[model samples]
Target: MIAPLVSVVVPHYEAPHDLALLLTALELQTHPLDRLEVLVADDGSRDAPEPGPRPYAVRVLRQADEGFRAAAARNLGAASARGEVLCFLDADTVPEPGYVAAVVRAVTAGADLVVGRRRHADLSATAPDALRRWFGGQGPVPREFDEPTWLREAYERTADLADAGDDAYRFVISAVLSTTRRLFEDVGGFEEAFSAYGGEDWEFAHRCWLRGAEFRHVPDAVAWHDGPDFAGRTDDAQARRSRNVEGLTLARFVPGHANRGDQLVWSHPDVVVRLDDTGAAVADVVASVRSVLTGSDAGVWLRDGAALAVLEDPRVHRGEPPASVLGRARYRVDLERPVVLTGATLADLAEVAPVRVGEHLAVRRTRDLHRGGPDPAVLQVPGVTAEPAQDVDLQRRWGHEDHQRRPRFQRSLRTPFVATERPTAAP
Candidate 1:
């Protein structure tokens, strides 16, 4: 079968250090340089755009200062392309060396649109890696390519188009995605009408799926994303998020969610914290956020997973898995014997005792970071881990690695803190 020419199109705006990393990776793709073209679309940055040259043979193009966002930039690159597959990548992401060949394989093996995985590359902000712990959240998003056997098969078996909105949380980021030129034009090209802060990809993909394009995750094709630098602050950007929520987009795309409260903590951009847990108390918290999350689009217990789907937040939805152990939806505290999950590291502990969790004065009571999600059950009982030695194995993600026989954590359980002790309290 004749292979299709692939275009590795990148959209850059005042970000070269990150862009260079992306280009460097493109240079290493297993696919021959002859079969691939790397093009950079300079979105009219204030400084002069890099006139990319040899080594990578990258084509550099520019557009007027219309502020159309990465979407517009990709459109411009596609307009000048000679490839059949348009591999759209954000400027800050570095594709894995095998990316091109993987895309080619998946597409030829039959996926019309293949989405790759994104791992967090750098923490450009102070304590970014730390703060990520404080909130019990992950970073750089967890792009659902986590386990792709299902993703690959789904795409190949049916030509039916898939969309992020269909799974909203997992389909989260538009970070590393590949699609055909046909899928591009039929979607009407990123809705130039949806100005600013970029939800255009989701909106555009929604349209394409509506038009008959298939989407899936390509596990082996990966990218390293320099996670968003929110500058240690949340501001007007929160307001701008409404721009994407304005049109009937939410009405049609998001089910079970309502307008956010006048202002809600943890309701930051690109990241979402949707509460799909309809358990008794879970529904109460859902009512609390009644202002923001609404609709028939909500996931039911039997349909959605067991407890809280962290993938709900647009940020987390797009695979920005919480950064530190504290950030992980699955409990990522980094060290042992202490409660500061954020500052903890590989040398530190991933879980702590109930007393340690409660002893921390910052918390007043226990509440799951997942809100209407699963409960971590932190409580101030000393016997669970010692004296009254109740044995609970620290759960580990299924890995191909063997187990080392050292108690991951050993301490007297004392105070009650977040994620400790599920309530048997009457609803």
Candidate 2:
């Protein structure tokens, strides 16, 4: 495939020196100059940066000073981007020559969300002579520092996150990440509500996961950050406070995770248990529903008027078949009779739920259903029976004209090969 045009977005505050260095690195990227656009997103700098001569196109977007609004600045840059892909970078991070090219390679290989590796260095004390020497490829620049080991291990163990689960969003860092414009637009831009630092990336990654975007980590797309990792920063107390606030902000959006003192629901119900009138009396259906709701706080979709009358809990949501709730809810349990559920069952089902509805359907039984044969969508769950030792409502059907269709994804690990050779600097 041909290389795509990329718009690199740099979020800056009052760091002109760092911003200039990053822009210099961008000018030397190995990717085709005509295929790249540089966008500098300024977050209310007191003294705005002056435009300077650069090989590639540069556009500076400024927003009013309103606390720390990096999220809003990035959103603004994305709104004005005119490229097929958006590559995000912090103003203080300078990329290697092959950074843009490696990112392009990953995207072409079918990754909708790609995170590049960030190598940190103590550049705060470096003079202009040392910086020029490093950029000029004349001699050794500086000593490389440690990166986040947990994040690196995650990518390697999962082979660039081909088998990542819901929690994998925690490893996605926006400081050096890239994704297609269409995918970014579909998820809606970053949550501008994050006025403080941290956690704008994780929320965006979760939204992309919900939209079925492929996430990959490109280690060869190396970038050099000006300082140590966030944990190693000199200001420890402020960092901890910001992290706490950020975690709470994320708990509000992501399901199954919550901070202490929060009244919000911690474990979200994955499936909406549906009870239909299966030739049973309303009283029997209501009793079955009560049994199902023993420990689970899941909402129930009631089709029978009698069942609806008995259960008055807020969790027992009543809706018609194929309601809007079905679209939002991850799973649907259609049963003839209610089964006694322990606390563990609901929690277990939530973990193993198929990523999307209609992808996989788990049912009580799968053999000999009445009328028009068994629904191909239903997958039988063994050893689970209704209370009072009941008959299978939609059971006894398997492998006649139907067999369980397991899901398969396009999974592969990509190893990026970066060129060490550098082009001579323009005079």
Candidate 3:
């Protein structure tokens, strides 16, 4: 088919160096410049960038300062876009030359949505920068290809594809997502409720799911992203994210990611609280399979001891332990926690932190704790009905390398690939 009109939508803020890299990459695209429309929405820059109208035919849309947000800007850009497909990018990301062309190729091949492969960027040696990188995988550019191409492209003709069942979330990340403009509007676009950052893509993806749009992972369409941004993650950011998280609870646990008792619930055995004065005490566990996480179960468990302390807190649930939380309590486990809970072997131990049900450890599995269903909790617990069992080695090596071996992706992601080749495109 004739090349579909394509528009690249960008929301840039503080990091100009990364913006420069993204611009440079796009400038080298093999696709014809005339068919491409690059619209950048400056989401309230602290200071306007000096580069004025120059060689390339890019349109810069400016707005008042509104706290480095991109969702509103995206809505505005999409409203005015003429391209058949709209692609979004962040400031600190660089797309390869063939990225756009690859996106179009995927769309024409019958995929409703296409996502760009993302690789972690390299970091400067400054101490602060290094710490930031470690927490968010914000280091130097990754040496490996962001993703493989064929895996992304073959999803088209879904029947031929071996298992579209696994890769069937029809929504891609706005960082480099493309779908027909028509479909985007039909779904009412992204929810402006998700202001500054975090989970907007997921919200929009869920919206698309509600509207019946299909998405695929396009690996060849690669870009380098500046790790995940926790810069704006203050109390307000978290509150907003939590609000969205709550609203999307049903969407999250059902359908695509149906409840599968993730790590948060399944790995309860790894965490135990012993409040005995001297082998003559009671216990309270901070984690549970499905009940609300009010400090009740744990509080009840803690009241029975002379001194209650935390045991295994690989991931801190709430900020620091509250001083007024019943008795004088302190953290127990040291170092980091393992990542045994979020794997595919979904487990459900009634209550991860077992409750004293009668004389026996009366435990009840969560409502949606099985695999192949909508899962509520982030960590996938193994859906075994048996009582929770502890792994001694897990307890021993709690923080030994911890989750360092796993790639630092806070969320799940798929790699996707391209359709046509343009001579001007660079690697």
Global lDDT scores for all candidate models: 0.50, 0.70, 0.50
Compose the digit string of candidate 2's lDDT tens values, residues 57-147: 8899999999999989999898899989899999889888899999999988899999999999977765545665786788677877889
**How many Å off is the CA of 23 in candidate 1?**
1.0
Query: Compared with the true structure, what per-residue lDDT tens digits does model 3 show for residues 232-283?
Result: 2348877766656544542332322232232333212212232222332212
lDDT for 104 (candidate 1) = 82
Clashes of each: 58, 6, 48
Worst 10 residues of 1 by lDDT: 331-340
Which candidate, 2 or 3, would have the higher TM-score against the true structure?
2
Q: Estimate each model's TM-score.
A: 0.48, 0.71, 0.48
List candidate 1 segments past 4 Å from native: 123-172, 228-427
Residue 73 error for model 1, in Å? Answer: 1.2
Model 3 stretches astray by more than 4 angstroms: 50-56, 123-171, 228-427
